[model samples]
Target chain A: MNNKLKQLDEQAVQYIAVGAAVLGTGGGGDPHIGKLMALEAIRKYGPVRVLSPEELADDDLVIPLSMIGAPTVMNEKIPSVQQMAMPLDLIEKELGRKVTAIMPIEVGGGNSLVPVLAAAERGIPILDADAMGRAFPESQMVTFYLDGIDCSPITMADERGNGVLMHAIDGIWEERMARAITIQMGGSASICDYPVSGAQAKQSAIPHTLSLAYDIGKTLFESKDSKQNPIEALLEQLHGYALFQGKAVDIRRRTEGGFTKGEAVFEGTDAYRDRMMRLFFQNEFLLATEEGKSLAVTPDLISLLDQDTGMPITTENLKYGARVVAVGFPCDPKWRAPKGLDTVGPQYFGYDVPYVPIEELAGGKGEKL
Target chain B: MNNKLKQLDEQAVQYIAVGAAVLGTGGGGDPHIGKLMALEAIRKYGPVRVLSPEELADDDLVIPLSMIGAPTVMNEKIPSVQQMAMPLDLIEKELGRKVTAIMPIEVGGGNSLVPVLAAAERGIPILDADAMGRAFPESQMVTFYLDGIDCSPITMADERGNGVLMHAIDGIWEERMARAITIQMGGSASICDYPVSGAQAKQSAIPHTLSLAYDIGKTLFESKDSKQNPIEALLEQLHGYALFQGKAVDIRRRTEGGFTKGEAVFEGTDAYRDRMMRLFFQNEFLLATEEGKSLAVTPDLISLLDQDTGMPITTENLKYGARVVAVGFPCDPKWRAPKGLDTVGPQYFGYDVPYVPIEELAGGKGEKL
Candidate 1:
């Protein structure tokens, strides 16, 4: 690998981690491992430039890449190095084409780094954004779905060297078939699919997501260095607001139909004193409600982080006695569209509240103190 | 409408019901309403021919159509006529292409008839097959997944005239996005997508599933009509075997994230007297086990029907007094492949049982006196 590219790769790890942390908006899982993976890939293969979708040709072949399975499993069974590359390689061979770029399906947790690593190892460029600006539990929650993109010719490779490829007639079949395989493959697999023209990619992807992730991560890190308020810094960076801060006191978890579903009960602390907050989590943090009233639901970002360190917390990693700050960020304007509301709103998560934009829910100040 | 075709449509409802019942294996929900919908559509439009995939050219477009939402809601709310046609029509305009054929993503429950109705109403031909020969709770379970088809570009429409179309970059995203939409659309919606060419459709689809369903359904009806053994006739027709026969003594249910998940405790009645068989349901029958050992899991058609009328009983509709018989049928041989197994076997549902083919599990001998 070129020495300069290697150095740049090292730089990207820090930048990406910072940016990913900020973009995570307090919900993407901690980026430590993701940063390491991307760093290693970049160091080994050479620096992969993060390009805007506009930079690519309209017909440039691109695939959104991510890992599909339980986040809880991901921590335990960390994927083999080749598992991620195998799916992309298979897709390339199957189509008899070369992928021009790699994109992340979502901006949260391990997904933020998956594409960067893929791009570096394959010596391809990374798109500077993701389909979903935040995290979601399933495969079809991206902007591509709203744009009518087909997620076919997807290759899912498990650690056992068993690979299953699904060429479903629609995206839903892809989820069902892939999920079945995922559960069978020991609940984790690497996926690469949703080929699109660069033009479509540009229109559908959240622009500059990588830079944003790096910037956010950097802000958190710098805040610590300068002895500033890290949480406040994050809010200012994303123009986000503090939703709540509390101490988790109870957790009830159960695996149902292969999905991790549970809730974390919290006793208010600091700003949330004398109040209780219950946060529900599946693959991503879904709902944060006080008493019986709704505070926040999915499609918008909801995150839990240590108050002091501003470090991220995975949903599965949450526990009692942990103090966290819940933060909220506005989603892509596209996600706020009627179609978007229909796809990812409070009502969709079984809450009866009408689609209240974060701006309105946050009291129109755009940031709660 | 084709008057000659209308006559066939009228006659086919009974056959379609039988086909739906058999294909549902036991969990397609009461086919009575679905049968009525198909009959009405057939009358209004024309007879829907179930054509084999081989009949089409490589360029012929095929779309897999179905409903996505809580099955219980479908049973109670029932979909308005237009909801079924809206999504496909909207998507057709978006793609600016004529849809050549419609197929079922899953062949069990209400999904089977929704597509037939759409095809008849749209005056399009219906493919004589489906992606999954049986039903699965989620949209992503299908043979198309094995062949690398994606579930994105899915068009979902509610009875309220609202529609959402997604183009996720992956299959799982499709589920996440569509599910939220389904929830927003009032707990249920009509869906039509997974368009494909006839060549790909043929290669990936379970061929002649409609005919198979019709045959099995006919045998069951005839058996019931003649006061013969309806269960025996179904077993013979499907080459399946009885799993257990019992009376439902207890049912625990809760609606979570839009799916009806719970347990049904059945007390053995006939040969299984005094023995307890537990059935699990999520919109469709997912698993059945005795004493904690899973006997059958999803993607392998599992259905529990009324011992008398042979009508299907939905998971949500299970009462404490219903007498039911559970049957296990061999899935399409295609589902037996590694890709197929990975896509729909017991392991896919998080059960640890290595697949014991239903035929073998039944020991080549079905329920008999």
Candidate 2:
């Protein structure tokens, strides 16, 4: 885990933005504003060092930071670097000490980029790892949470300078209180939480996700100029497969628990003309099915891209009659554990299906209904 | 303003408990739990000194405290002294200073007693004044709020040790965020907020509310022994009038936005037979009308008592077919000011009526429907 540290440059943020969107599973948050903010911070404060988790001092204070609330709100109400840095500063003030490093609580879309601004300003390294290799709607659905890290003494802030500090007995309650605060703070807030020792970060975090996301993002970006299909490039990078290519026929959405929850129906085109695909999501795409059989379920990353443009489509942007391609990739092997399944598997998303690698579910076809 | 102080003994707690209930205007909280807790604290920590608003240094810190969320939740989930004390201690730590005094944010129901324990534990004086002489649903409906005291740096705690510190731009935002937190904290939590200087408190607080509530309670208590009607005693103390005498023929209630909001219809009895009286409320009773004319509107105190027993009936305990007498009393003279009307008048309650004194609305008969 302790390898050469990388610099969080402008070019890297661009790729990570795209990669994070893919892994975001259509939740996280809009990456456009986050990218702009991160770019400005890195430009103003110099590139932040991406430190390997194993390089952490045993006593170092490693805090996880992200935005919590409706992704739609994140898209509309832009957060400031001051807002992003507030929680970090408040945490330091509350503990009456300095935070040694910053890290993403989850790596997905805007979440992957939001913390970069803070890390840049503090002139501290950001851990090259994250709690969730991909975004999760709730804070409790993380390896760190499962490993018994109390995500309390958590601080949050809005662009208008409103702030809240929360401490709960457990991760779930923390998320509950944080969500309410976010909703009240005009729906989107910057959060700094899950304060853990460097030793704990090294043991519990999913390693090299930042580098992995950056690599995936680079591939997607380069493919656009190389005349290679971006979707195919992403599939090759993830060792995933094209699960379906269809026109979204009907989409139903409703907001619940501070999340956009809905399902999309797709009528397959091309070779799979007669096939029907259904996708269910709450903040993130958690389940995928064809006709009636379960094709993929969470812990497996399910992402949808514009059919021609290859840009990752967020849940908030999903619409009827859009031609899109859905892909499924296997998650970090650590997520295959029983407890991991309990944390974010199909059952956690209310789907009654056993975990199966996306490759196994796809069989031989790169494009399956 | 510095006159004399009273010691908060168990006997005073009992009387203040009753007084606060009458002033709670049907919304404060469960008086039983608050009385029990305040008494226990007084018994264990000894009596708290009741300070007059003027009895303070110019810079003495006066913190207002209360229980926030649904009265129903307060009834179901009783809070402990540890929970009550968490916020005050957090505030002290946040401000890096000792709070010199405790004041009720609202002198109604359990709110009047929630601060006593904090005063007892700190061995500080409890102010004999409050933000609201009678209960109002939202925090912004107080004179302190109208006077522009920022409600932030407010802290709340739950029974399970879950706590949150909120800093909002204004009192309304504070209430919005606090309401959401209260809902998540199992619908009720103890909060200590609006830390102001002694000078500010002396200028803005509704003075003598503690003694007013106490006097009302004592009058009711002594009247019970003397075979005098407690309602008449209460009215004498408030300079109010009997708005109506009737059996609660119909009661409609439903929980909304974490508050019990609805109305009750009463069919006038005896000399007022055939006339109907209607009471509208949200947490606290906000208005009363005879047929279509307004008899009372907030910032006036509206209370309902058992027709025979003379015990106050909270909105949570309201039931159909109970014979009750409704009374309306003028609020503090300060509440009749323009700012007060804007804060809690009939329009704030969605009623298309102007504020009118209960005595003026009563026409000729004290017992008129």
Could you say which candidate leads in lDDT? Answer: 2
Worst 10 residues of 2 chain A by lDDT: A1-10
Model 2 spans > 4 angstroms off: A1-5, A227-229, A363-369, B1-5, B363-369
Candidate 1's displacement at residue A186, Å, is: 20
Per-residue lDDT of B43-159 in model 1, one digit per residue for the tens? 787788766777889989888877777766777777756877787875685567989988877776466777877787767887777887877766666777667776556677777
Model 2 per-residue lDDT tens digits across residues A194-236: 8989899999998888888888788878888998888887787
Candidate 2 has a TM-score of: 0.95
In order, the first chain's TM-score in every candidate is 0.92, 0.93
TM-score, per-candidate, Cα-based:
0.54, 0.95
- Residue-level lDDT for A54 in candidate 1: 67
lDDT value for candidate 1? 0.71
Tens digits of per-residue lDDT, candidate 2, B1-369, equal 122338889888887888888889898887777799899999989999999887878899998888888887788887787887899888888889999999999977689999888888878889999898888888788887888878879998999999888888888888889999988888888888789999999898888888877777777778888977788767766777888888888888877787888999999888778989999999999999986988888888899988876678888888889888988887887778887788888988799988987667776447633
Error of 2 at A281 (Å): 1.5
Q: Write down the DockQ of candidate 2.
A: 0.82
